[model samples]
Every structure is written in C-alpha cells, then in structure tokens.
Target: MSGAKLVQGNEACVRGALAAGCNFYAGYPITPSSEIAEIMVRRLPDAGGVFIQMEDEIASLATVIGASLAGSKAMTATSGPGFSLMQEHIGFATMAEVPCVIVDVMRGGPSTGLPTSPSQGDIMQARWGTHGDHPAIVLAPSSVGEVFDLTVKAFNLAERFRTPVILIYDEIIGHTRESVVLPDRVDIVDRSRPNGNPSTYQPKAPAANGVPPMVAFGDGYRFHVTGLTHNEHGFPTTDPGDTEALITRIHDKVYDHQDEISAVEEFMLDDAEVAIFAYGIVGRSAREAVLRARRAGMKVGLIRPLTLWPFPYAQVADVAAGIDTLLVAEMNLGQLIGEVERAVAGTTEVIGHLRADGEPITPADLIAALPDPAGART
Candidate 1:
C-alpha cells in the first residue's frame, strides 16, 4: 500500500472514500461508474462498512442520507442518467444539512447519449442540478492520484460544511489506468457533534462558522429535519422572516468562505501572454499544449480548476488579467467556457475549443487556437 501501483480512477475513488471513513455506500450500477460500486462491494465489508446495491439511484441517495443522519459517513457513485434520478434527494441532503459524498463519472449525456464515451457536458448540471438556489461543493480530478486525494477531500469538506459534496470525474479518467502511490496517512475531518443538553439541542441553529453541529438520530437528542424552510429549532416554518434567514444561512455558509473552498492549479502562468483553461481529462491535453507553446516561443500557460463548483473565479481573473487571450478546451460543446468568459469579463479575448464527438481535445487542437504571441500583448 506504500509503493506506487497501477490503479484506475474508479478504484482510486473507492480507496479514498474508505480511507476517509466512509462507513456506508448505497448505489445502483451504471456504465463508467459501476466500477466504483463494484469495488465498494468487495472492499467495504472488510473495512467494517456497509455496501448495498439499491433498487435505483433515487433510493441510493436516500439510503446514504439516512445512514449519514444515523452517524455514519456515507457515499454513492453514478453516471449521467443515475445522477438525474438522484437530484431530488440531493436537494433533500442540502436542505437537511446532511454530510455525504456523491461521485459522478461523466459520460456523453442528455439521457444516456453515450455510455462509454467521455464528456464535460455535466459542468453546468453539477452546479445547478437540484431545483432551487442551493450551494454546492464539487471537485474535479484530472489524474488517478488526484482522484484519490480529492475523494478524501470531498468527504472532509462535506463533514466540515454539513452538506453534500460531489466528486466529478469524466469517463476517460475513470476508465484510464495510471500509477498512483497510496499515502500512509491523510488528514481527516469529522463532523462536529452537539455537546449541549439534549433538551436544548437545536440542529438548525446558526453557528459562528455557519456550520451547525450535527447529532445522530438515536442519540437521544430531539430534533426535526425537513426540506421545508426550517427555524433554528429545526421545525417547518411558515414565517417569511424565518424562511429567508434559513436560505440565506445555507448560501452564505459556502459563498462567504469561497476563498477557503476554491482551488486551482496554475501551470507556467507567471510570464505567459496566452492561457488555456480546462479541467478533468482535457487538463492533461492543456498542460501539453502549454509546454509545446512555450517550446515554440509562444508564451502560453494553463489553469486547471481542481474545485469546479465555487469556480475559482478570483484565480482565473488574476490569470486572465495578464494574458491577451484565454482558450478554453473541454470535451463538451463549450459548457465551461461560459464560466471562463464571465470570469475574464472581456478583459481578454476568450475562445473555446470544444468537441462532443466523444474524442478528447488534443494538444495540437488547443495550440492552433492560440493567438500569435509575437503580435499579442503580454
């Protein structure tokens, strides 16, 4: 477990979840994401955890949410169609302030469009999948090693924020095999449990950090949880003032700490005039394009967002300010480029190199879109 070994992204996700203290998993099998469920089945029992293949994705998320409420760290994995079915429960977890992890291995999709092919079409969906205005924490991994690390981070963030977290990986990364060294230990964070008298416990009460301490259902602490707007005591509230406060608290909890939650990987950006913004598997190609552009004396760089939900706007804007043009490469028909455009805000010219034909954007493809450095302003 110490030395490097070849691992697929799906398998790495299983290991990471187990290591992060995920004691329960409930998921239905689906292409490109089934491997995660398969591995969890073989491994969870040995780790003193529970693994159940639910009837469907909806039930899967519901079961995970119940287990989380009962004091177990839980997770689920799915592809595009399955992800669609779990939207309602995802909203439930958010409204109830449950802590759990959900993995989405992206494939070509409106409805099972291409089960085995890679796509980034879910970028917008992941951000706004569930109905209503809810905050989300999503992490995208570009490599097997990152898949392992980010899976652990996902669980930690979910517990820390008392909300659901999504770990997004494209089909290409999920199916691809690469060498990864398992670390002996990783920093772990557990949800804070209520320490006050059971009679005085208020599950929905506002904490200074905006994350309320959680208590288990059978712990003799009385509390109510509902998708409806709730008061500090956790009961359904009809008061306009109470409803507004509840919604604002949840949104502010994430957005107010945006700097702490956002993460981006910058490559050769310090002195570059042109840049490539990408994530997931396309980031691999963007890195190569940046190197090739540098070798040819065209100062180009790459910015890969490791945390996609918060969107890394500040870091992206900082990079955009120094560059004359920003190129966004993705496996979708320009899904993420919109975010890049908003972040840059016309300070620099933004263009996209996109494909939905189930093929990855290559280094040469991104290079071709790069503006001529000799004529571009630095």
Candidate 2:
C-alpha cells in the first residue's frame, strides 16, 4: 500500500482523512459509502484514532461534532437518504462553527429511490438542504486519486474555516478502483486554539481572518456553544445587530476566502469554442468526450470543478465569455445547469446533457450533446 496501489475511491478518502490527521469517525454503513466506514473501523484504531458505528446518520454527525469539540479531527460517511437525515446536524454544525467533514457517496434519491445506483441528485442538497443562510464548502472528485486529494483538502477547509465540509461523489467513483500513488504526507490544517486568558475568551469572536480561535471543551476553556443567534460570547441573543453580524460573519468567512476555496480544472480550453461543464464521474466522461471531439477536429474543452460550493461563478464566467456554447453534463436532471446559465449570462448558449435514471453519463452522450463542429465556432 506504499506505492501506486489500486484503491477504490472510498478507500482513498479514508486514507486521505487519516493523512489529514482525522482521529475520529462516526457513521452508519450505507451502500457505496459503507467501504469508507468499514475501512475506518479497521484502520482508525491502528492509526490511534476512534471509530463509532452510530445508530443512524443523524447520530453519526452528532458524534463527529462532539469529538471535534473535544479536539479530534472527525468525519462521517453516508449516502443520499442518510445525508437527508444528517441535514439538521449539518446546519447545527454550521451555526455552532464545528469543524468536521461529511462524505456523501450519492445515490439516486428523492426518498431512498435507488440504493445501489449512481446519481448526482444531491448537488443542490449539499449546499441548500440544511436551510437558512449558511456557508457551504463541498468538493467533488472525479477520480480515485483526486478523491484522496480533495478529502484531505476538505479537512483542511473545515478546520481552517470552523465549518462542516462535505466531500461528495457518485457511486461509480466511490466503488471504482484505480492505481494511485498517494502522497505519504499532506499539508494539514488544525483549528486555531485560543492562547489568551481563558476567562476572557469569546467563543464566537473571530480573529482578523474571520475565524474564531477554538479551544477544546476539556482544555479548560469555558464557553457556551449553541445554535441560536449568539454574540461573540457564544450565548443566545436576540438583538438585531448581533443576529445580523453573526450570520454575515459566517457567510463572509467563506466568501472572503473564495480564491483559496474554489477549485476547477479546465482542459484544453484556451482555443476552444465549445465547453463541457461537468463534475464527479461525469467529469471523467466529459474529459474523454473532449479528447474525442478534438480528434474529430472540433474545438471542445472541459470545465471540471473540484469545488462545488461557492459555485466558482467567476471561473465559469471567464470561460463562458470566450466560448460559443457550454454543455453541462450531470447524472441529475438540470440541477447545476442553472448555475452555469446564470454564470454564462447569455454570453453563450447553454445546454444540458442530463440523466437521473440511476445511469452514468457516458462520453458518447456528452459528445452527442455538443453542437456540430461546423456550427460550433463563432
């Protein structure tokens, strides 16, 4: 396992979490994502970490939050239905500013719709399911190697921002095995700890970086943690100014760091007139489709986003400005395409190659969605 081992995407995630200093895992096993929990149960203890099999996804994230507050880098893995169950806690984590990671290996779902199938139906849910005006950091990796990389990045983002970060991929990517030479070490970011007098500590007071320094509950720092609108002291408050400041600060912490948090991979886009905007497993298909379109003398390219939240609007707008058309391919029916259209802002024609029948979008499907070569160029 030291060099270029063939690893499933879910396994890579567990390895990356461990590499990122994740010392706690709490989750209920579900299809596609179960391997992550299964591997953690065996690997975490060996790495001097703790693993708990919770009764359900809700409790899974709750345990992760507690562990994180107790100074452990914690995470949980689940699929669509389980993800739905965890939304309330996700919001609580966001409001409480708890640092944790949640891996959602997506399956087809409105209500346990397809358990063993692949679908990108949760794209919007990852950002909006928790409700209210909240900040979100969600990463989607297309390949096994990238899965490892982004999982590590997810932890770093969570710890740096003091918020929950989600790493999501479809069933295909989760179960697929690929040879990857994972790095022996990766840059890890831990939550900033308070160094001043514990008595004067304000749990919700942010530093210059817009993130509050955290002190573990057992570290002799006494501070209240609640989901209600609280001031810098972390106690519940109903004052208009305090409530507004609290919400705005949380959202600004992420938006202000958009440059560091947003990641997108543009493939052969400089001279291209037509672009494919895809992510997750569909991104792989889009990559192949771009190559095929190039072989056929078409100016095709790809915009594969590694970071799903914060939308990468500027990146998409820059690409859209120069392209004649942008094709959005996803496993769901038009979830993120609207975002693309909004970014495009009518600068170029936007079209969707969508599927939600528990099937993966293939290269041919993306290729077919492209305009003919003769009409593609502006």
Candidate 3:
C-alpha cells in the first residue's frame, strides 16, 4: 500500500470500487471477471462493505439493484455470457433510475465463444443490451492503471446520473499484470439525496440536470419503484403525458450532458492526415502504431474513446473533419467502425481493421493498415 505494486486489471477494479465508496458487491463467478468477484469477497467486508455471490447472473444483478435501493453504492461484475443474462435487470435499473455499476470484462462470445481470451464483441451490446431506448454510460479502459481510474469514474457517473454505468475491459487488460502507482486520493461522488419532507417527496421529480434526487427505501421516505413507465411520484402510470415526461427525462440525463460524460484521449491529431480510432486493448496497440508511424515520418494519429457510449460523436467528428482517412481497429468484426463511419459521414474515408480470433491487435497490424502517405491527399 505504500509503494507501486503489480496489479491485474480486475484487481484494480476492486480497488477503484472501494475508493469510490462501493459498499455492496453481488456477482456470479465468470472467467476473467471471476477475479473481480474474488477480490470483492476478500476486500469488501474489511472495508465495512457487503459481498454476496448470487446463484446466477440474473439474481446477481437483481441483488445489486436491491442494495442500491437500500442506500448503498453497489456493483456487479461479469463476462459476456453473464452480461447477456443480466440485460433484463440492467433495463430495470435504468427504468427505476437506480444508481449502480456493472463491470463487463469482455471475452469472445455469441454463446461462450472463448472463456479465457479477449474480444471487443460487446461494444454494441453495452449500448443496446437492454430492450428499450434508454441512456447508457459505458467506459472502456485500455490499461491496468486506467482500469482503476475508470472504475472510479464509472461509479461517480452512475451516482451523478442516477443510472447504471458499465466499465468494460477485455480479457487482455483484465488478466494482464502491470506495475501501477495507486493514487493516494481520488475524487468520489455520491448520489444526490432528497432534502424535502418525506411525505411530499416526489422520487421521480426531474432535476435541472435531468436526474432526479433519490431516496433509499426505509429512510422514512415511502415511495414506489417499478420498471414500468412511472410518474413523478414513482407510481406506475399509463398517462401519456407522464410516460413521455419520464422517458424523455431519462434519455436527456446522459445525452444532453454528452460533453461532460464522454471522454476521449486524442494522440497527435494536429496536422495528421490519417487516424486510427480504437478502444480497449486495441487502443493500446494503436497508440504504439501512432508513435511508430510518427517516427517513420507519417502523419498518423490515434483517437481512443475512454467513454464508449454516447459514442463521442462530437470528438470523433472534430478529428475526422481534418483527417483524410480513419482506420478503426478492434477485436470485433467492425463494431465501432460503423459508429466512426456514421460520425464521419463521408467527410473522411473510414476503414476497419478487425480480428476476432482471440488475439490482441498489434501495432504492426495497424501500421500495415494505414493508407500510403504520399498517395493519400489530406
């Protein structure tokens, strides 16, 4: 605790969760993500927190939601398959406006594809895993250190927005061990608690930021919470006006604050003609490719979205406007590339370098994908 230590990405997540005041963890063991649950079990109680291993992924998420409603910052961790199982509860958390965090350490999958290997196939799933149209905040971290930092940010965002936040890590990052200097102090944000009389409190009353103040159950504040479209008082209502207001508020809470919620790390975009847009582990390789390309006198840059959802359209568009060609590298078969293409909208040529063979994309692979600098026009 005094000096830098070698830590795995999954362990860093537990440390970050503890730093963020996470007091409850409920999860089922799944490969790559199993370490997170193991660490939480060992650490949570020592920090005066609670940890429970539920029967299944679905029950794990449900328990997490229950803990959040009971006034605790709660979380659950899982891999691709478990994530698939928790989709319904994730939507429930969104609809009920529950504040919690979900960590998905991605592995290859379309149904248990590769348990111990890395993949970015869940990029789109993180955005659209749930059934309905709702806002989502998904953060993808590329390094062990980032895994720690972003997990804290995920919890903060969850509390601030009053919704579930996803922290995504691929198998490479989750299992890889690296020396990391843990920060002595980190910024923590707690959910906004209601201040008015309990009897008259409207649990679903919209705040200026489009997030309503939340009160835990048994806080002397009696209120209803249901997945169904509810009114301002937290009751199920079929009223068209009330339904519209609730749904619209949920969407705007994150989308309207896109600038603040979306974070991107841009590498050497100034005067660049070609760009590589990547995330998760692939972004790490893209960083190396940019450095190597620059050393070789090629105007190449990298755009890594630390926040994957809300898609970082504005940032990507700004960078895309100046570049002639953009290459999207990922472990999936062109999931994020489609978003880059949509954001660029023919202003620049968008290409994808994808691999789903349970291997990490390499810098050489990315460099080879770059357009010829001499032949390409800016």
Model 2 clash count equals 0
lDDT of 3 at 201: 92
Question: What lDDT tens digits, residue by residue, belong to model 1 across residues 149-172?
Answer: 999999999999999999998998
For candidate 1, the TM-score is 0.97
Rank candidates by TM-score, best first.
Answer: 2, 3, 1
- In candidate 2 the C-alpha lDDT for residue 24 amounts to 96
For each of the candidates, the C-alpha root-mean-square deviation to the true structure, in angstroms, is: 2.0, 1.8, 1.9
Candidate 2 residues 1-378, lDDT tens each? 557788999999999999999999999999979999999999999999999999999999999999999999999999999999999999999999999999999999888889999999999999999989998999999999999999999999999999999999999999999988999899998899888998899999999989999999889989898988899999999999999999999999999999999999999999999999999999999999999889888999999999999899999999999889999999998989999988888889998899999989999888888999596422
TM-score of model 2 relative to the true fold?
0.98
User: How much is 199 displaced in model 2, in angstroms?
Assistant: 1.1
Q: Which residue ranges in model 3 land beyond 4 Å of their true spot? A: 373-378
Give Cα distance to truth, residue 146, candidate 3, Å. 0.6
Top lDDT model: 2
- Candidate 1 residue pairs in clash (backbone atoms < 3 Å): none
TM-score, one value per model: 0.97, 0.98, 0.98
Tens digits of lDDT, candidate 3, 122-197 = 9899999999888889999999999999999999999999999999989999999999997867999989988899
